[model samples]
Target: MKLTDLDYARQLDREDPLRDFRQRFHIPTNAAGEPVLYLCGNSLGLQPRGVTDALQAELEKWARLGVDGHFAEPNPWYSYHEIFNEPMASVVGARPEEVVVMNSLTTNLHLLMVSFYRPTPQRYKILIEGGAFPSDLYAVQSQARVHGFEPDDAIVELFPRQGEKTLRQEDIEAAIAREGDALALVLFGGVNYYTGQLFDMGAITEAGHRVGALVGFDLAHAAGNVPLKLHQWGPDFAAWCSYKYLNSGPGGVAGVFVHERHLGRADIPRFEGWWGTDPSTRFEMGPRFQPQAGAGAWQLSNAPVLPMAALKASLELFCEAGMQALHQKSARLTGYLHELVTSIGAGAFEVITPAEPEARGCQLSILASGDGELLHQRLMEADVICDYRRPNVIRVAPTPLYNTFEEVWRFWKILEESVS
Candidate 1:
């Protein structure tokens, strides 16, 4: 629909099923105390109002129960991580046994690598996207170094064809076929952090497995933003940070998924710790390490109770408003944003993200012809909180939970003024 069609936009908002959810979050305001059009959920989600109370409960537990809080509290701090499993699994389309909440994103990536990326001399290379996040690049490079392989030789980066902004599935498949025999693992972000392109995970996994390579994903930007089927896709492993689309706070705990098929594989070596030992026998202080079955075996230490509490609160909200419903709203909202940006014409800005709705999440990455940061600064000064990436990209994500159609229209109006 044409973005200038204000009546139609209002009708869309009125018909929006998830519209009521906006009230649940605390939208930030300018010094004048008016609600800011917050389109930065792709970076950091606005905090849900209930999160403070949930966190306070954990604080009260700590204050009242002392050291005994681990086992004696209302939601026992010892098994606090378990509270997140089912809802988290449901969010990602995985079984409860396949998922576990643990440390931060990069840390989980390293731990999953310890078990999944066992590189032999003959098959020592890893495949990743060309412009992967810096943390992912560092982790992959370090993993290669530990395996006695040069990063230059062991890391294969897939790039887009000349003049294209995103990688094609056929190209990704061809690369996997050509290098599959020598590749130990295939790991890519589920959605490109910069370009906002959603990779075909199931197809990618099939192609990688055909050549005997383990497949995994960093779903940091994709987890709650896009629909996922990690278990059905047959990926060997996956990891994600909850801070972005999950609406857990910054530096929030992350989640990992290990397909149940691998649960019984004792040969799969891990960086083991006592927290991963069988819960019933964990207190025995035994010499042997009997890792818990399923993804729980990946746990390195007891979970942080406060973070878990906050996560629990957010996931409960997601559970009440199912991901399917949110995804429906996301598709339309992002489509509307895309339409508005295009209506502004190509000379002012170009969308770097995929054009097809199926190819991306809610994020519409606009590349300004010149002075992108200047335009971004102007938008911020106008109390519109979208984020700017280096060189030229400004990413605006209309989060389904809290953003409205009117806010999206207001963002573009401000953009039009900035560019004019």
Candidate 2:
């Protein structure tokens, strides 16, 4: 059967092992009460049906136990964040002690930077990808400025070769070597937001370490979307938001992974807080701060029970489905989307994302010709919920958890019509 045939797409869906997982989420409906073609999991994931019950459980605990909920039965509020350590570690492929669910994405980045980005007068530059997500760029810029250096001088942005859509691994390695001993930190996004490029994080980490620089990644697009081995890759630190591929709600609790090598190191400077103190001694009311042994020490405040509850619901689904399985399904699903988009004739649009299945996750960033915004509006009117960047990029993620192959096929038809 032709790949463009609707029957072929439906057959793929029928044979999908992950097909049953789609029903776990609450898909949004159009005016006529049909589910919209939701391809925006790269921006915000569909709500898991389990989220309501999870939130209600916490609310009920608060109502019944009040402050005593801190130590109450089932999942206690005091140690709420502890439950995520192992599960989140599993998602990112790290040791349980190295992972902790904490503050928002950029907030976690800043906190981890406080410990990792120790800029000396000689080695003061932070290397990042060009056209990084605005939040990451801002965070690194501010970190450099805080250390008394101009942003332009202290930050080195890596761009692809002339006329290239995505960066090559060789180029990234060459850039790191060029920076050499002068580089203080190598901070990058695990997946480029604009191009949907999944960087070779393990290689990047290795290269940075060879140059005596600490490396880290903002896994906003990578987490849950791709299978990561953070421990084996051995980046100094990493952080990610649960809201996107993790399918946690908006403004959901974010997470951090501090390499076990950095755990309990007294030399590392971090902004300390009461909750970060040894939990056994946290209630001692002592002035001298004795930090917890692992990533938990980075916490500044007690867990936000409600937000964590919402995340916990989503994490359960991730845990059940498993990252390896999800990633395999993601590659196939996104590969289908890529095939459909590219088959729409070369002049209509360009797929800026890497073609290799291993080089990306679920997203395929289409650089539409002419008015991309008009095409985006047309997609919205057709009840397709993908996202558009300012210039010409349309990011469509056929998330493995809830999105369907049929939707991808229908989206291609709509995109072809809109472009013409």
| Top-scoring candidate (lDDT) | 2
- Residue 60's lDDT within candidate 2 is 94
Top candidate when judged by TM-score against the true structure: 2
The 10-residue segment with the lowest total lDDT in model 2? 340-349
How many residue-pair clashes does candidate 2 contain? 0
Q: How many residue pairs clash per model?
A: 0, 0
lDDT of each: 0.92, 0.93
Clashing residue pairs for model 2: none
Model 1 residue runs over 4 Å out of place are none
Q: Model 2 lDDT vs. the true structure? A: 0.93
TM-score of each: 0.98, 0.99
Q: Which segments of model 2 are wrong by more than 4 Å?
A: none
* Tens-digit lDDT track of model 1 for 331-396: 999998888878885598889899999999989998999899999999999999989889899999
Q: Model 1 TM-score?
A: 0.98
